[model samples]
Target chain A: MTRPGGRSARVRDAVHEAVVELLAAGEIDAAIPKIAERAGVNPTSIYRRWGSRDHLLLDAAVTRLRAKSPIPDTGSLRDDLLGWAEGVERSMRDRRGQILLRALVATMAPDEEPVEYLRARGDDLQNALDRAAARGEPVPTVDEVLDFVLAPLYLRVLFRRPVEPGTAARLVGRLLTALPADPAPRAGRGG
Target chain B: MTRPGGRSARVRDAVHEAVVELLAAGEIDAAIPKIAERAGVNPTSIYRRWGSRDHLLLDAAVTRLRAKSPIPDTGSLRDDLLGWAEGVERSMRDRRGQILLRALVATMAPDEEPVEYLRARGDDLQNALDRAAARGEPVPTVDEVLDFVLAPLYLRVLFRRPVEPGTAARLVGRLLTALPADPAPRAGRGG
Candidate 1:
């Protein structure tokens, strides 16, 4: 299906596609003229629209990375956590995803949208935690969720280490073990 | 005090110092000839000795980053972990340290020594865990140590977020809470 958008939107999409293709080809050091040539767009327009190569790359890359990992609530925190972790691993395994994540790691600044991009990616984990609490299961803090689940995954990606099979399940098991043995009454309420 | 090393050693030291200085100055993309010139060393000699720019920067940076944070067994895992966290935070806060870390993140490849450099940095944490086990404390696994302690600190570093005061203690407290309630006898013996 053709995407319904204005001419400018179409141009943007073309440019983004070019960015992804070039980045996927491992042309991380590709200049603006190269990207514009690949996109068949004007170099001035590309520079005027994106301002910097970093911004252009980040915009396209963040869209790709975030697009692949939509967390579905499977009605079980274990399932949800596993799904999230698996999605992360799958993204990391993709060449485009690898380029994007590495570029994000290398070029990300505190002021950049990638910071917000990363924080938004945490929503699925947060949702899972909230669901667990709602069901009276042991709920972990946001910090715990980040450290126990997300951090290890990102570390593996950063190091280009293959996230071994069963890693997610093991992480979830550890999270469960970390919870209080005797579930406190109404523990999830107000926490 | 006069250094006892020979001429080659002195040349290596000067080159390494130049690496740190250039990295700290945020000249991350600086060329090899520039670095050699800055170090007052012959460019050919520099290339022959260090093999590549990345190696030179990593050798110097890893030495500095690791040398400062020697995690001593402080009789309590909490104290030890807290000390380690604080050391990491301190290193990250330093301008020179910040540049080194950024360059490392940028230039790091899966096959590079920085990967080993990072893994080796975890030895201190592993040592702390072993000490905890020896004392019959509810010891965590290497994964737990990486996730619980190192990950959060690294996340902050990666995002350029300030590691707020008390963050380290809070992380330690959470890790302690996550441990089994009744410690097993001689937990470290068989494992």
Candidate 2:
């Protein structure tokens, strides 16, 4: 599909892929001129496409991350949470994901754009949990469930600890068994 | 009390207070010479005391943070968790605390000593939780409880929204109520 802008999807994809490659290779501190040269595009074209280095890098990193793995739904809330945790754990273990997370954290300096992106990503995960809860899963609030399951995985990542096997499964199981049933009929209110 | 190191505690306090003032004034990126000037000390003396710029900054920040607050203990585990969360939220709202958190996250890359200091701080919080749990609190595991309660506060600080009033309190109440009784005291291996 053609974007509103004149740039074709294919061209945008190519630029994004180039950006991902550069970031994965640990050239995050490289100059925009270097990025343009690596992407084989004129500096003006690159600027026109992404506006700023931070914007381009954030877009490319988030796009690559979304493409890495899908958050799974395995017909059970427990399984789904476990699967999602496992995916996050694996991503943290991968070098590219680590670099991307660090970059994102470094860039979040009480700014509007980064804050908006973070909130949107969090809402995306929260939406998935909402869907599960609507399907009559035993979890109460998406926020609580997410915090209970994902926080430890992130702790391990930030602290450089080995992601223990079955840790995700155990966390999911405990949360599932312990969470109180939704008190009211779940419909449109995405917790 | 007089120390063996020849420098008085008063001198150390003065230097640390100067560092905090510099950081609070958003001058952390200033040169060591400038910091020494601000502290009314020779650069060599500052170096002799703290070894390096990173060491000086970290020690000063840590001291300020530790001095500004004590870990919460509200008798009930739920109240304690909520209190701790509220304290975290307040810190995130403060300018100095925000800078400190950003500084810690920035130092997480390929820097061993700083990362070790960060981990020790987290471990200290976990130890506090352990002590709370040992006092007949109903939380199942210290690791799980700490991850669920505190990690989300950090996530909020790093990403997502600034913590809202009572968000932490509500989350703590939900989690505490949801937690199951500690598994029947495990018996030693049977004969």
Candidate 3:
């Protein structure tokens, strides 16, 4: 693991924190110099790290969101999916997370920011999927999860639907029933 | 049947057509006067009919999109679903439909506009769902169709995914399997 006390790691945490704070304060177009000043890091370091202000904003939002909700490693695929769904529900409910979700929604149109932000978010979902597959568990494909789980979460986000407690469970249940790991019967299995 | 050639009906048609044209031409903020001019109608009549500019825009977009797609009544739940899915795919593929979809997505925030715009669109889905039930066929709940079929279709709209012919069939297949009209067997049935 990267050294937690390292200056570089501390700087990254500070910069990301500043980005979220500024975004919450409605500084969606906050300049890099402002972010650097808020984070107490050199502008040069931020530019070298993220290449551009937009990149840094997207990175901060996604990185922090992912960090807060690491993909679950529950032994059961059902539990794993439920955990993943709850984490997404929690993320969108957060004030900062709402800002991030809006940011992602804004990029739904063509020629906005590059889609790498969404693609990078896909990696988190993939990590959960790969974990299920590695344990010889049936796993839904990435697209299925997106369609069944993520789509509903985001649709709720789109509609400003209040997140109910059982929302994630219901979504995961539907996904499990629809796209079972290996839907076919196993010939070698005996009762 | 309603009179299609009535003066009021003609006015409504012209105004809706004008709204869609203006939206596609990148005049998202086109005022009522502009819309009236484009439709070759009086501004007073536009306000008299729609009451407000925002109302007119929402009414026009939803009306035109719904008009272009009358809900399918193919006499079978499966085919009806397939037809409904294909209609959604076709709508989002259309240039004007894309504009209206973007308009809807932009309202994903807390206070962008009324949720009635989306609710009106939801009526289209309900029409198909209602049709299935009226025929004594098993049917998925509104949420099931939203999560399974409509979610993926709209997700493609969000992600700019290409429209594949099998996309609707695939989505409908999963929905049918996941949420059958009656998953349990009848008490008694003779062949």
Candidate 4:
């Protein structure tokens, strides 16, 4: 019954690392016992820390991939947003990340906890925009910009098309300039 | 194997109708065998036509819900685009249609055929704009306009929030006004 921290922290990190490797290698259906053995942890430890195989795998994937790379704070909001869009385009270009996202989308139900966790990551990205807006930067609601800025990247990755150079930046530039000088304040705004 | 025509067509229609009923009743999983039984066809027949359970359900849903709604051409491109946006907002507000879209998103992978089918539906809406442009209407790329115009709607649906009334029309209006005016036709270009 070791907790997540004590001696189990090392084991948990090892298990997470193993899951990422397996997922990247397209071994999604690899046996759970094999993962535990590879991580040098008892299967019970995994089950104790993560309730099910899906939860463990999803958590591992999220932890490994969830770096909040900073959004640029260029003097102009337009430039900053375009910069963020470029970053998104670059991330979607990574084959492993694309595969991971596609796998999650295929298996995760919209109402399920794993999907919620994935959405929380999306929310974190939106929160960064909100942070910028709170600093007196002119910007539209996160939802308004989210799809336009991100869809091309998702479309490219999911459809197996090349992310056309400058497409993301162009979209971000267009949307930012198109936004009203001051968007209507969001209801119940909070980061 | 009998094709869907004559009596078989009627039976297929009946089965698809029953599936819609079950889905509306929030019994998607229970609808499958019942649908086959009601249609007097083998469950395998449904599976054969639709591939998987989710596919069968979604195709049935789309069959029931598909509409050839009109896009307005009110002499002004801005007005026409705004009208189209309003139509999209209306369709998304349709309770049954929303349920079907939600179910499809939940069950399909981002790159899976079902998801692609849904994306194609969205793309068709964009294509209407393309058609208008090709008819010498003054507009930028339909794909670009679509990205901005539908951004908020998609975000709201995917994030499980109610879209604000008038938001669609306002977005379309804003985008139209923000766009650069059509370039003046080349002078003295008598064909």
Q: Which segments of candidate 3 are over 4 A away from where they belong?
A: A1-61, A111-117, A180-191, B1-11, B27-37, B40-56, B112-116, B180-191
What C-alpha lDDT do the candidate models reach, one value each? 0.71, 0.63, 0.71, 0.61
Model 4, B34-146: lDDT tens per residue?
87886678888787777777767667655554442345657666767777777767766666655565565455543443234444444555555555566666555444555
Backbone N/Cα/C clashes per model:
0, 0, 2, 0
Q: Residue A81 CA error for candidate 4 (Å)?
A: 3.4
Candidate 3 clash pair list? A138-A181, B138-B181
Superior candidate under TM-score, 1 versus 3: 1
Error of 3 at B1 (Å): 8.0
Candidate maximizing lDDT: 3
Error of 1 at B150 (Å): 1.7
Clashing pairs in 1: none
Output the better candidate (2/3) by TM-score. Answer: 2
lDDT of 2 at A39: 71
Higher-TM-score candidate among 3 and 4? 3
Winning candidate number (TM-score): 1
Docking class of 4: incorrect
- List model 1 lDDT by residue over B80-153, tens digit each: 87787777667776667766666666667633432445656666677888888789787766656666766776
- The CA root-mean-square deviation of candidate 3, after full C-alpha superposition on the true structure, stands at 6.3
* Ranked candidates, highest lDDT first: 3, 1, 2, 4
**Model 2: runs farther than 4 Å from truth?**
A1-14, A17-26, A111-114, A138-142, A183-191, B1-28, B72-82, B111-115, B118-123, B126-142, B178-180, B183-191
